[model samples]
Target: MFPPLCCDSGVDQASRRRHHQSRKMAMLSFWRDGLERQLAAVTAAMDTLQRQIDRDAQSDS
Candidate 1:
């Protein structure tokens, strides 16, 4: 088992748990934002490629 970080009373443990949860939520939010931006960029690039393909198909016809 992992060693205890500190000698935590009930109130101290509750406070520490809340602090950890808040930090974890903030980190998740940061990752979600980065992923959203990446997805948007990928979608835009795909759209551009699709347009180019359509243009080439029309020219070939």
Candidate 2:
């Protein structure tokens, strides 16, 4: 999911900075979680591959 593009109505630049930082954090939250899930899946796949390779090597010995 993408974060909404919002316009800041604050007259002060500091408030605008804070608002954008909050928005960026919200956007990254989804991506951070997603990457963690993907990493877990890749790790599981590697483990499975390693096990299969080990089995094959044992059979060949």
The candidate that wins on lDDT is 1
Error of 1 at 21 (Å): 0.4
- lDDT of the structure predicted as candidate 2: 0.84
Task: Give the Cα error of residue 5 in candidate 1, in Å.
Answer: 7.2
lDDT of model 2 at residue 7? Answer: 61
Residue 15 error, candidate 1, Å:
1.1
lDDT of model 1 at position 7: 56
The estimated TM-scores of all candidates read: 0.78, 0.66
Per-residue error (Å), model 1, residue 59: 1.3
Model 1: per-residue Cα lDDT over 1-61, one tens digit each: 2335775676576777777788889999999999999999999999999999999999999
Predicted candidate 2 versus true structure: per-residue lDDT over 1-61, tens digit per residue: 3433766565477776776798889889989999999999999999999999999999999
